[model samples]
Target chain A: MNNHVILDVQNLKKYFQVGKNLTLKAVDDVSFQLHEGETLGLVGESGCGKTTCGRTCLGLYSRTDGKVLYKGQDVHLMKGAEKFAFKKEAQMIFQDPYASLNPRMTVSDIVAEGIDIHKLAANKKERDEKIFHYLNLVGLNKEHANRFVHEFSGGQRQRIGIARALAVEPKFMVLDEPISALDVSIQAQIVNLLIKLQKEMGLTYLFVAHDLSMVKHISDRVAVMYLGSMVEITTSEELYENPLHPYTKALLSAIPIPDPDVELQREQTRIKLEGDVPSPINPAPGCRFKGRCKYAKAICSEQTPQLKDMGNGHCVACHLYNQ
Target chain B: MSKLLEVKNLRVSYHTYAGEVQSVRGVTFDVEEGEAIAIVGESGCGKSVTAKSIMGLIKTPPGEIKAGSEILYRGENILNYDKKQMSHYRGGESAIIFQDALAALNPTMTVGKQIVENLMMHRKTIMVDGKEVKLTKRLAMQEAVKMLKMVGIPNAEQRAKQYPHEYSGGMRQRAMIAIAFACQPKLLIADEPTTALDVTIQAQIMDLIKDLQKQLNTSVILITHDLGVVANVAKRIVVMYSGNIVERGNARDIFYHPKHPYTCALLEAVPRLDLKNKQELASIEGTPPDLLAPPKGCPFSTRCKYCMEICCEQAPAATDFGDGHEAACWLHHPLAPKDDVPFKTEVRHE
Candidate 1:
């Protein structure tokens, strides 16, 4: 990996044996790279393996196959002290702050938990200073250090989560729908805080969310996932302006514009998919979206499409652009 | 156009051990017949409380409806209605769709059974050609299946037998819509129905609600924090802030050209897909004031970017801006002294 590429995931596959004969392919052959100081947005519906992929990348869930390359080395191959060091370099900010944090611990102890585990702090005074520093970094005051998680609001609790993630001073962070559980007003504050911290710390982020508007705002590049595969990946502006994949178009069109006059004139006709998303346990041989895809053809059902570059770093996994 | 529901100076408070926490403060808005009105605001803005107030669903003890509260459903004071009268109104003339599908639905009961129970309760008898006929449980079940089909649930008959947990988030929402419309209520109050759902599912649910509203001619009160969801579905918009109707106007008027500062701040706060360049997403600075002892003047004075001394000193009364557009802010109030600072629309790009 080059200096531009902070973390590179290649053909990552994670599967689980659900029963006697069935194998659930959670993340199948997923490949993406997070560039230094850039936010890469990962967007998909629920049960699409986006969460699983994030956890697998973080080493929280052991990968069934493939490699996670961080800073030019295979993450799984690292051993002993090197593997422990890698843990400090890559951290995650989870979706639900209420569930992610330890309810029993105070705010300071929660932020200091990682520091204590890694033995980063020199002494008790240094650890206390570090904890206060991180809490302030995420816009929390020193007084919040003594407060319990329950005392804080949803937004403040999320801020604490962010502060905990930042305490380790990780170069790359995986934000798993951080703002999905937050209120709209509070969401803006958190998103803005994340952007500020990213610039200040020169940090790289893999921001995963289902909100398109928010994804567009924060992401330098975006990777759109469906079922268990990545359908498209491109720069945020390019993806929004000149989408190549049919699914991308459908997703973009689905976003409700906040104006009634425009909405009235605009055709709100959704490409109504007949059935719910199929089970990931035993996915079909063809495109995962074949059943719901309006442009699906006979070939779509017979063969799985591969992600092919369409020039200017825009990649799509649909046969329609495969000429 | 005749008003279907009119909420006048509705105040709801939660009697916590700490104190009486006022949730909804002197909120007033009217929903016309066959019109879809969206109440858009952040959490704790009294959006849900307003909806609960209209439905007569506010739980007492912890939650208390203040003395001045007046909810007029078809020009009748619903707050004064007895239990029997209210029962006739609840789920019969008005129905509510809550946010959480799992919590809203009974896990043990199948979706079909729930819909059938509601249909039987609200519409036990139907009129056909001036003759009334009673509906059996079997007929109610069949009608429930049909209702599911109407909400665009494929394989409705088969899926209806499955419990709520068996259905996907999108399907459960559709089932909820089916139950809500099973009664054929004149007014449907959907409280953040799509907020808990994903974007794609959110779209589907919004479309479903719109389609059903058109078909049934049911006036809808869409309660949501998402401004995007409100833009398309609602004919009119009511913006609530700290339990007050800060702004009310046509959806287009509010989105395109907002008069109130709070409304403008809210619009700016939302992250838009079309925006290019990276700029800080706008956020309202302070937390909402404690409702028990709300600020004397404008509730939003502390957070308002263009706040003046008058904003903190005296409460601003609702000022009509003609064309049925109204806003409660010192900026628009004529008697209030004008500030030197002019309203600025500095477009921040990222």
Candidate 2:
């Protein structure tokens, strides 16, 4: 419940051209705000443009429309020292730890890349000390500084990636599926480390992931995306307990709980979405989830539904609710 | 219930340059007829190796099944089967569906042709109008379309004519399921079948498999790392850790009253949606033991919180808690020292 806004995105859009004429609308008219010292989880299945939305918010990809404001300054329009300052203030932790870090570089060098680029340390000693400090902060020790990325396990390599992200001293971080590639036993370690670091450093995070259960665990608030559109946004507790959107209900029901008793008995209540996600390319001029929604009506296919606030900061984008 | 498959004292090792990696050591479990048994474990825990060994798909040179391993299918030991006998037993009696449908399916061949090929290899005749008719290639293709339709793929006839890449991830998985059930294999091995799919699509695929399994009475060996996935589908749960079975029990028993420290750690590790508060997840402290140089004692002894003095010296034997629920942990021993803190039974809320 942080009242201060760290980053504000409005009508953000990112489109990729496929061939001569085909355009894939990766992120379309998505808007959200990240509060300081809070984690906003963006949850959606594969190809729903959650990753694209995260990238566009950080100016990693040029937005085709809308604006991304970082501390009331247009992120896309920044230049020179301001842009560099923004880069240092905002960082990203990639999904694939294996590919994100340079295999040839030592772990120290990998962590120190952001430090050296930002010139945070004065000399070689200061740089090495800073690198070692970050490595230790992420549960790694001094012995792992000199080893190459390949020498480390998936969890360790992910630690190195986190060290690299935190080395820049970013107030805001974009964690794109940080734990998806990790093993089950190791995923909790990374999540706990992130939560601990966030509490200690007062860092704000935009955690984009498809794992809804884990997302709800770390995020203070959650946003649901469907086909490059924001379908729902609310507090993590409210979103899970009283989901208003049909897609959110279906998604929550689809997730198999580890408890066999509840899952077996609740089988009849589980909503199995009949078809796959609709194509984002040349999308229909209507609610993106209309194709799979059971309550879709005539108006659902004619006009795109806009996200409307339904009191207490809960928002949903569906014709049945909005109309 | 009759036993569909029985594995006993199975051990598997990989020939690495460093040494022989004991991927699976002394694993034993049995699958009853039409029962769904889930083999759950993390990476390098030898769950996949156990499934592969059961399917006879392990390559001999680099990967070897130890001499005493016994894989009995329908009262016959499949481990001793020759190549011809294994081939006949594999396609005709059992089949497997992989995680990555695109990678498992042939790219060049049509989906129909692939299913038809599998049918031709297994079936020679079909009942038509109460009379036995010789099954031909065309008839198999027709049956292939029907199989695709059975799995809920719309426009099955046209979709069958398309290549694997033409279908989406969920459709491809459905196609894979169709091919697996084409022969109506009495035993089906689904190795992380829904791991790569989305949750909604994952739900759909799981529902399809369960429906078909009931219709065909196919005993399934669902191998996966996610404990949540196996809850609804599998009647029995087998928890493995570092090439060993740490716990085996009914699904409800495993979820409600997990005895093994590793199982307790795992149950606590998974983040539940029904949790009211955003508390920290309890992760196991260390990584899995090295297969090449396995620990002298229990595999999970390094990370276990309830590890006792004797646990570091030798592996614990299985302790039965009645009704086929068993756990291999020193905490269950009668003479073991009681700790001040008690184990929590209900990790999740209703």
Candidate 3:
């Protein structure tokens, strides 16, 4: 990976107001950086703020606080032409392929929507050519150009979503659970296609997914999230091999290996986390994961810990790691 | 262990706008008492149809279980059973838990009442104070709460009194499991039980299922696409592709010494959590064939890398590898080249 920082998020926070005096802190005090051609995976369970954080970084959701900088320019502060340029430079692939693509629009029209917006093509023939080019790049044939989005299967629809994002020629992409909806046999195909495309296009990616194995497979670095807080961030290998935080350890251990022999061996050493994730709305003052954390202490509910670097660029936010 | 359930030559088809969709085509398997078996495959592979057929949940007019299909439950052919016998067979002898607990459960009834009604229908007596007594409404309510607590749900009393929507995803699933096991049925078919749950929760549920199977000594047929989950809970696995049994073996046999191309490709396809280094995933080349006018040969032949000329024309019969392990593939034929089978020489067997 290059030393150039493509995207930098600083102390980002996004909140939603539900009741008269209640505030839902969806993405609270989360920060990370994406290097050129590097894929940073944001992983957490469902209802965690990983999706919200990705959206805030892409300027899809306006941040309630902090700044999201793209190439040294603030994404949320961009104006008319600058905003348009940022949109062209950054694209998002949604989680659900079935719901994301418009049913009425043909595959060619869905893909060319971005190309036409950026005025990448001059004539109708050029537009058609650009459309088919992206479709082919994602493993679809030109014959699929005229077909409706509903006609294709889940994997094909995801490919179309990828093609739509790539048609914009974006330097940065935020893939939000792009392969979660696809089947087991089909997820690898999409993951491989994404890796191949990143290599060919030199694109930086912010891959947000709940599937930890795939996240580790596709990411250079990974950030683990709790309710609304980032519990750990480190190189993918280090995070998987030597997780520090209690929540991170539990999360990693919870993923069942495909091998029966390994699963048999791991059963004894697995960390069984107690209770469910607590409510994120008006969450307690202490650590967000203290309710489910096995190693939580008295001070854990009083003061929230910030991310601290241990070594080798590994950061853990917990009282146990604090000392 | 005796055979608790046996499905022989199971054939199911659905009527669509175009033609009949041959869903479960000649699937055959048996589950021994107290044993947990898994039916694994991708979408449109008829794993769910097989599960539904076992539960007698298939609609007859649009969907039909063809003649000669037999789902024998303890020497009794359930296919010939009328409505009264079918209802008696369901829940009393066998029960199924669905993927979406929210949808499967009744919206109007309290969780406790649903369990109570299920218990009242299937069972008449409860073990109280080490004595068998007629089940009263109050006793059934307490039994329902007991079942809820057994499935690891906390505050069982209050949670049981609440509606289905009031409970969380994991809790609702726990409640569903409670109801399924309330009757202490001999057979339990969990259709993708944890597919909608998160990873950590999925592991928890799988563990709970394993524990319950041991406690109740109930036979289980787990239907899911997740191979990792299959590894954890299933003793034996039956792999399906396009409504056909592609491979069947013990968990170790399928994972360590897979012979079928589809099975090998599937194992290579998943990005395992045990991965030490970055590696490109090996994927099957094409999508599964359409089942409307299903192919005559191996359905996986269209995408199999080792597909031979014979594979396209004829379906290969099951080749046994001893110890209840078998795979349907032409490459396993004695005349076929032996060296070309990549998964044939895995290190674990030696």
Q: Please name the candidate that would achieve the greatest lDDT relative to the true structure.
A: 3
Show pairs that collide, candidate 2.
Answer: none
DockQ, each predicted model: 0.70, 0.84, 0.79
Docking class of 1: medium
Residue A142 C-alpha lDDT in model 3 = 95
Query: Which candidate, 1 or 2, has the higher DockQ?
Result: 2
Q: Name the runs in model 1 displaced over 4 angstroms.
A: A1-3, A268-274, B127-132, B334-350
Per-residue alpha-carbon lDDT of candidate 1 for residues A101-176, written as tens digits (9 for 90 to 100) = 8989999999999999998899999999999999988889999999999988889999999999898889999999
Stretches of model 3 off by over 4 angstroms after superposition: B345-350
Q: Once all C-alphas are superposed, what RMSD does model 1 give against the true structure? A: 3.2
Put the candidates in TM-score order, highest first.
Answer: 3, 2, 1
Model 2 error, position B104 (Å):
0.6
Tell me the fnat of candidate 1: 0.73
Candidate 3 residue lDDT tens string, B167-206: 8888889989999999999999999999899888888888
TM-scores of chain A across the candidates, in order, are: 0.97, 0.98, 0.99
lDDT of 2 by residue, A90-109 (tens): 99999999899998899998
Better of 2 and 3 by DockQ: 2
